[model samples]
Target: MRLRTGDGGETIDRQDIDVNQVRIGLDLSVPARLGGLELTPSGTVHVRRDGGAGQTGDGIEVAVGLRAVLGTARLDAQARTLAHHRAEKATASAAWR
Candidate 1:
């Protein structure tokens, strides 16, 4: 995904792909904050099969994310899970001027 802010601001873009034997997927997110806070989240899922003409196999994936800002502090959280495996992570930061 690609993101752009106002003039004199900044732009950011990111992409991710998973190359595995069982599953393959991609995810992208971009967000900008002016005075308060901004949040954006997105993801995708794809499953591979042993032998098939078109897309096959029972592929299942889920993603959860959140972004928040209070005063001079900001927080973001994200979680992802595929098949039977699960993973989660979070981050918190602050700024002052």
Candidate 2:
């Protein structure tokens, strides 16, 4: 679990724009061994609120993933979704080591 806050500003031409936000996140995972392989399942959630011009009111992100390891080989796969006022996005990724 984690919590964070941030403030930022940018200047373009002769105008200044500012943004402030607070975010909280939590992650959980469990691992189990089956024979010679280790398998883990994990999930995460993040919530955020923003204040400033053109900023979205609030947002949330959710994700789930799986990881497997055996000897020197490791594999991971994850899918995530981010949703906010007026827009939503989704992503997925996999990696091998």
Instruction: Please name the candidate that would achieve the greatest TM-score relative to the true structure.
Output: 2
Q: Write model 2 residue lDDT over 65-86, tens digit each, in one string.
A: 9999999999999988764433
Q: In model 2, which residue pairs have backbone atoms overlapping below 3 Å?
A: none
Q: Evaluate candidate 1 by giving its C-alpha RMSD to the native, one decimal.
A: 18.0
Q: What lDDT, from 0 to 1, does candidate 1 have?
A: 0.50
Task: Compute each candidate's TM-score over C-alphas.
Answer: 0.34, 0.64
Residue 47 local lDDT, model 1? 45
Candidate 1 error regions (>4 Å)? 1-21, 46-58, 69-72, 78-97
